[model samples]
Target: MEDINLDDAIKLIKDDMHSYELLHDKFLSYINRDPDLKNLVHSYKSRFKDLDHLKSKIERKNHEDSMLPEDEQKGPITQDNIQERITDICGIRILHLYIGQFEAIHKALMKYVNSNELALFEPPKAYTWDPEYSKTFEALGVSPKLKESFYTSVHYVFKPRADSNITCEVQVRTLFEEVWGEIDHTFNYPEPSKSKVIQEQLKVLARVVGAGTRLSDSIFELNSLQDAE
Candidate 1:
């Protein structure tokens, strides 16, 4: 595949950045209005990708592709398909307190997908490395993919229509996982961490995050059962 001229690609993205911001606001409003989603989410955050971060990501992807053998490398990002290739230009993150709550939150979001209000740009991904947490996702019909960094979250990609260039990615995770992710992001962004000691501690923190979610779920469940009696 041919390389994209950095200047041309950046110019093209800069031109379309406003539309992405509009799309971000539109999706954010939808979540705020949806009754089921409003109750299920403890809080939410949204942002369109920053222009400089997009430029850096393009450079990084192209560079990583160059290091791989010809047949193994993914094609370089091009101006023709940069917006389509980078699906998370606008992103919304849904955070809740308990793992038990994810199934309801996911189901509520899927309503938009099922109704085609938002076209499914990619299949949903559940990210985690814990075997027990993996089963939690699988039981709700989402397949778990092992995240080597042990960063845990569930991601969904949606676009306005089946072929729309404007897209948004929604990430669902517990408050506990959110804390772990922020720490991982600090170490691994722009460059991977060379510090093995830091990596090991992050892995340990991931387990603690999972346990926190489970413990929160258990407390809610027992309290509900008692109130019903």
Candidate 2:
């Protein structure tokens, strides 16, 4: 690929910005109306990356890799590979009520991938910190990555079809976990909290969030059993 500076990359993205917006809308519309997915989705939010943030991200990523050997470095984002490199121009977070609903939700998302209604940019994996929580997912055949962060979510990158390079990142998590994430982000952003006490509190809070999810799961299970009775 020919060398392209930041300005050129930005121009390239700007010129084709309309098409990205169209792709974003196409995905947003699908999630809103897709019967299998919509019912399970408690709520969702979608966005295209802000241009200013994208610029910063590109610059930071390039700089981070600048020290590596020439052959190993991914040079600036050029027009040729912008869409492929910046996969999450359109990102959606799907929050469900309880852990019990995840299997159905994952299956609904996979149905499209299996039928070619959507294309997988990558295989799905669950990012988890708790061994017990991870075991639940592992039992279902979806591998869990043992990440150190409190972050937990199942990620799927889907393209509209085989022909389109445009991608949407979907993050699925329980509403309980979503609340904990927002609360924990306060101590983590910009830098981790300087206070060791705060760090310990956050860990305790994370465990509380996990317990809440388990309790939610149990309540839902009881309701289902009562219905069967």
Candidate 3:
């Protein structure tokens, strides 16, 4: 594919923006209708990438990849890479009350993908779920002492239907994790804060959030045990 300039790319995205909005609505409807999924989630939120934000992202990726010529770096960027390259143009976030609920919801999503319940545009194998922090969280089993990137969300990519190419990203996180994410995103998103103190404080807060989630899980387990008697 020939390189198309940044203006052309943004135009292409804007032209198809309505379709992405429709896909987001379709996703919301699907999740609302699925009893198991609805039960697992404490809240659901979604957004389409803002045009300016999308432009910034493409420029950032281009710079990171060193794809543009040195002299043309600040010039009109050209690339046919925007469409397939950007995965989260349409995105949804699923917040669960506990960390334990992630696995069940993930499994149900896989089942939906396998059964073609959402009219998948691609095969089930195309979905991505290999975030390092989530793997560490599962491996460490919610221990307070565990130290890894506090980022804790399982992400999946999907299309609203088999015929569309627009991709939506689904992010699943526990309530505690969501709290940390919001604070972090406010001060440290798109780029991390330069303040050493804030960075350290965020790390400490992450540990606290982790501990809180563990306590919540324990309380639920205890209640379940009590009910069994």
Model 2's alpha-carbon lDDT is 0.79
Write one digit per residue (lDDT tens) for candidate 1, span 71-95.
9977788888787788887888989
Q: Rank candidates, lDDT, best first.
A: 1, 2, 3
Could you tell me how far off, in angstroms, the CA of residue 14 lies in candidate 1 after the best superposition? 2.6
State the C-alpha lDDT per candidate.
0.84, 0.79, 0.70
* Residue 61 lDDT (model 2): 67
* TM-score of each prediction: 0.93, 0.84, 0.78
Task: Candidate 2: give the clashing pairs.
Answer: none
Best lDDT goes to which candidate?
1
Clashing pairs in 1: none
TM-score rank order: 1, 2, 3
- Candidate 2 local lDDT, residue 23: 65
User: Backbone clash tally for model 1?
Assistant: 0
Put down candidate 2 lDDT per residue, 1-229, tens digits, no spaces. 3333676676777777777677667767767888877888899887877877777777666666676788998875656787788887778889999988998888877877888878888777898787887887887777789655577788888887878877888889999888877777887764568888877787777789889999999999999999999
- The clash tally of candidate 3 reads 1
By TM-score, the better pick of 1 and 2 is 1
Cα error of candidate 1 at position 207, Å: 1.2
**Lowest-scoring 10 consecutive residues by lDDT in candidate 3?**
121-130
